[model samples]
Target: MRFSVMDLKVGDRTGSDVFNWNGLLVVSANTVLNADDIDKLQRHDIDYVDIMLRYDGKSPEEKPAAAIPQENETARTYEEAVGGIKLLFQQMLQEGKISKELVDQSFAPLANHIEQEKDVVSLLLTLNNKDDYTYQHSVQVGMISYYIAKWMGKSEEEAVFVGKAGYLHDIGKSRIDNNLLQKPGRLTADEFSQVKRHTEYGYEMIMKSQLPEPIALVALQHHERLDGSGYPNALRSQDIHPFSKIVAVADIYSAMISNRVYQQKQDLLRVLKELHQLSFGKLDAKITQVFIRHMIPNFIGKKVLLNTGESGIIIMTHPTDFFRPLIQINNQFINLSDHHELEIQEIYMR
Candidate 1:
């Protein structure tokens, strides 16, 4: 079975050779992991691996299953959600339709779990895996959309519904050609146009299925922007559905921070900055601000590396200066809002 590096204990044995994102070997097949091995895997940002078995006290035959560390339970849940989405996507491509029952099974667990899990920063680390970017992106967008809805004062039921919308936003892509979806190189002009049709494809698919109108609209209009620069249909602010706007914000944030075949993952803080910039004309300002406002506070105790090659703990965040926070190095305090020359090069959410 596949286990997240976060979930693997010291005694767990790898079922296959483990490699980092750059394809460098980190661990050999069937290697019995120690504390350092686990730490090295975490440092390498290796998300998951195939585990043959685990070694407990008595003997390998009598060994019990590993107990998930409380800290890593969320990552385990994320892995399950990713698997569910992969199954659902495969079913859609084969069947040419969505199953509401399958959608609930795949997405509901993660959505319910994330609401209780307050460590939003850590989610950025564990919820992502480059191998299955599409499935992982769907889960992230759904979770983020739910948070945006709740933060914006929507009722609980309403928020969950909006989340379902976000979860299915890309279901249309299931009907698209497999070659185009997996292409690593630049997409041709006509290929890009065909890709854009996923919006209409998703809308039609959902409408034909048992899901509601709002979810269908989200699939169709998640790409639409406030300034009418989006695809499928050039929908201005009012013409776009409110739920779609929430999904749009979630979609952009998830896509930017995710590691994909064609695009490398951007720094989390830098992606937030880009979102803030997009809020002006491309995205809905209120919804984007709500997401950013709630997300920036998660950096309070995070470790950050500065552009000057120094590292510090984020002690406090500035209200006016969203990205730059008050960082503490030993007993010295650096207020990044005041030091405009210094910049946060990276934020260590994990």
Candidate 2:
């Protein structure tokens, strides 16, 4: 029976393969739909789907197993999770560790928001709060890592797990002194060294909290660069785990794009360009390229304000020009790659 996506619930099996308007198959036939699957359908504007109905003519398991909360419920999920995470960090500072249960309580709700979010470009621009830098960074990095993992073709379970690791990758920073963490100026040699140890502290804390070894490893190794320039163990390229490398990319992007007390946020596009350059030897080349490849496409359908005071809607992005795109304005299509003087100043995200 065809049912509105709004009415479909978790455990509602798809009776047929569901494809988006773009003709991309998102969910397979006979697949048991989860919150993520259902939300993806709605985001794609898929209104009616063939839901498997039992012989009695009702969808199996008439009651949904807590389908991703409706709009009213989900709007509060991210803010509430951030508040809970703030408390978790404070608790970690006091006790030196936080239990797996606590970690789950603070972060699990965000899976709904994370799964539903496709506009990451706007997400980064809008959600960042400089005052709550670390807390917000944790959430953004987790979300970014989750998307990166999925883009790299990781399974849902694996991607979510990687997201969780990214979320806690900086938990050790809670143990550091507030003065050092919030300092507005460059740290002294001694102070910088102390800050770097947060990796070990984070690893120990996560292990003590009974999270997995991989989670602890991410905390420890996320700072480890492809070269031996990073802190803690300084494990180079082949020695580092891919999960840690993934979080590292997420961490750098989040930290750089966010407004820090010491470092002002750069333009979103400029940061991606930097990431492209960093991919050479400092970061994983393949991983960084994958991020740029996927992220560049987000411009295809956005309304943007150019530095030249012109406004246009992005018609399509170019293959090699990562930030430039073909835009439509005043009935004319402008290929940004050919217009070097035109720069995107603002993305009017709705």
Candidate 3:
């Protein structure tokens, strides 16, 4: 059976294959799709459906001839893990309590899910609109930290700890004034000052709870840049905690790509450009290199509409500059890196 965009709604019944649509996926009947699934569909030229479609009643017993159990397993793992994270974030925001029981219940499953699937970035991206950016940002930072630890070849225990650190990196923001948090325009100096208090607020919040001191430290130092340009405390490179450094990279990358009230969402290449520009001063050069070299390449294969109103698939990426990747438009290789006249104006993920 074929479905159109009109047939899908926020809560509608969908088949397992409902997510296979070529554009604008409507919510599945009951199953929630994640950012990874959305990214996969976009990479394959499918659009609209950003997450999994949930179905009602009994699940279909009939399976596709080409069904890959591994993919389904991975998808389910991500859904459960992300769902738990969302619940915890909401609970914390409302109740202002980090229950040890909740942490204990979710940690193993999330850790296992990460271990089973090596791609944490995809998982985080798939969770894009699962909730507000504040909550999702926390999860994304956690996932990114998990991946960074793994990429750096850290042990599983260390990786999980790092992930936990990321999960709480912005817990301080919870105490900030809502007006400041959700302001759509440029923040006044006083508003900005209020916003900056999140780090300290988060540190105090975590310290009051059962969370370890290291986790609190990570949250406190997340804003502290390598060159001592950060806030609360202008700790330099060597002074910043390693976990905090990891969270800083993840936080910045996620924030850049995320759609915000004052700032439009940036393409992967543009985000990487910003990271590369800030590498020495604001971010760690070595980690930024790894992120650009290994992480950013995955999103390049999809088709994108340039700011110039031209469209094409990303054909090649420059080693030093990601924003100038070559695009294959109408069978022509447009080398954006070498041609200063041409730049990707914007990315329209198909």
Task: Give the alpha carbon lDDT tens digit for every residue of 1-350 in model 1.
Answer: 99988888767878987766544455657666766567667755789989998766667543432333444667777778788878877877777777888888877887777775544665776556547777888888888899899878888789999988998899898888878988989999999999999999889888877689999999999999999999789999989999999999999999988877688887687799999999999999999887886676556567888889988888666657767778998799999889999988777753
Model 1: CA > 4 A from native:
1-69
Q: Which portions of model 3 miss their true places by more than 4 Å?
A: 1-96, 116-125, 129-131, 346-350
Number of the top-ranking candidate, with lDDT as the measure: 1
Clashes counted in candidate 2 amount to 0
lDDT of 2 by residue, 240-324 (tens): 9889999999999999888888998766676888898889898998888878766664545567888889888876656567677
Candidate 3 per-residue lDDT, tens place, 202-252, comes to: 777777776888888898999999889998899999998888888888899
Q: How many clashes (backbone atoms < 3 Å, residues ≥3 apart in a chain or on different chains) does model 3 have?
A: 25
* Comparison by lDDT, 2 against 3, better one: 2
lDDT of 2: 0.78
Pairing residues by index, what is the TM-score of model 1? Answer: 0.77
